[model samples]
Target: MSIFKDFLLKFRESFKGTKPVIHSVLGNVFSMRVIGNKTHGDLAEIALTEYINEFVEDYSAVHTGKEKFRAKKFEEDISVTNKLTGATFPISIKTYGVGPLQLSTNKDGSMFSHLTEIVSKSEITNSQKIKDILKNPCFFNFSKVNVLPLIYDEKNKTFKIILFDLEKAYNSVSKVTYFPPRKYGKDRETFPIYKFFTADEQYIFEVRYGGAGANALQRGMWTHTENASPFFNEILNGTYQINEPLIKLVSKILVSPREKHEKILDLLRQLNGNS
Candidate 1:
């Protein structure tokens, strides 16, 4: 190759690669900076799914008074059994973070929406027990509910865990209903979830819609990992207001929704005129 070409090739190689900017934002003014995962912390709802048990166990020694503790974790919550009472009641936890609340009530993946779709067309919806449960459909039936609050602060680089009882936190929900664009892809409208609390609860989170989150409906539940990192503000010593969520999907109430849905979905195998 020519000397000039060789020089050009070597120079191009040096500029060919650069570390990827994992996150970026620009508005009002002109400025640019490269950022890493360190900037955008893991949103709390995400932290709950990813590290609920770990953080809970991390703080359990400091918080609860129960004994012979055995635990189990599912999507967004945990159950600590007071072995003395044989109760594996679920307690909720979350890392303080940003983004939308995303406990979908009637969305596709949601247990109730999925079941509602199934039962509406099936015969088992006729079962007395099932009928009684669906008659109200209030709060959309969920399991082992209690709320425990937690804060994962980016500044301190630590998780400040707080415990809460959903049983006492003003058990109420908005029951929002709306249809999504074709992109969301469901014949029915969606219902995002929200669990509220009285002043006594440790934390509260809210999404001020107008940005991307508004475009995609969210607020309330452990939605995704992308939103886990949150800004933490301390009030009353680890007592901040969190938009608390009640663990509505009680296994005792729904009789194992996963199993129930699975069995019922087996229409060829589970259906008959009267059996």
Candidate 2:
């Protein structure tokens, strides 16, 4: 098994102490398969708010249900407050497939215009430009933004809830590139996408300029969970794994390639030995 598979398997031992109510909430979440993605996302927000209150220690969660007032005032779906310290955390909840996940939406063209201006005026490196833009208060408020992504991996038929450390990610960024709308595809002439990278040139995320006119509502920042996963190993230890069928064990053994199969066996041995 690759490092990623090993990491996931270790965390897959089933989360303990989960509230029973959460199981029912998750059931409702899965039942929304026929619903639109937007409705699905709304349900995920409610589920996540409840999940945080149940599992996370020292935090009280409040659901900021789709109110236009809160949307304009806050950038997060859930507001978490530390019970002891009274510190507050603004969390954005996203429900997405294993593909690219949007980190934040750019309803207006301000983010795009700001970035373009920086690129034109600043002689700094792409990373510096990103850091600079983030520092601007005119951009997305709250420097310490936290993302709670509920990712559904279609291939594994599993759901994973993990934290995308946007704060740490900002520092890790080493490059940022702009991709204007392609001549082909649905995005053609609709919007532009900005790709972010780490020091090693690993892709971190993208700022998608949602299309023009009615489509403009689609704008947001995005990232692939596969690419963003490694940046947050410590957070991964607390991942909530769900939807895996019992048959996965036998199916994996039968379908995995020989090399990967052997690696899985080796990892199992190591786990057993440690136990």
User: What lDDT does candidate 1 reach at residue 15?
Assistant: 25
Backbone collisions counted per model: 31, 1
Clashes of 1: 31
Candidate 2 lDDT by residue in tens digits, 9-36: 4223324455544444554565454444
Segments of candidate 2 deviating more than 4 angstroms: 1-27, 52-59, 68-71, 83-88, 120-130, 138-142, 185-190, 210-217, 233-275
Model 1 regions lying over 4 Å from their true place: 1-78, 98-108, 111-138, 153-275
Full-model lDDT for every candidate: 0.29, 0.61
Determine which window of 10 residues in candidate 1 has minimal summed lDDT: 23-32
Model 2, position 141: C-alpha lDDT score: 60
lDDT by residue (tens digit), candidate 1, 171-236: 321122222222345564334332222233222322112223333243223332223222222211
Please list all clashing residue pairs in model 2, or write none if there are none.
Answer: 210-219
Q: Which candidate number would show the highest TM-score if scored against the true structure?
A: 2
* Per-model TM values vs. the true structure: 0.29, 0.65
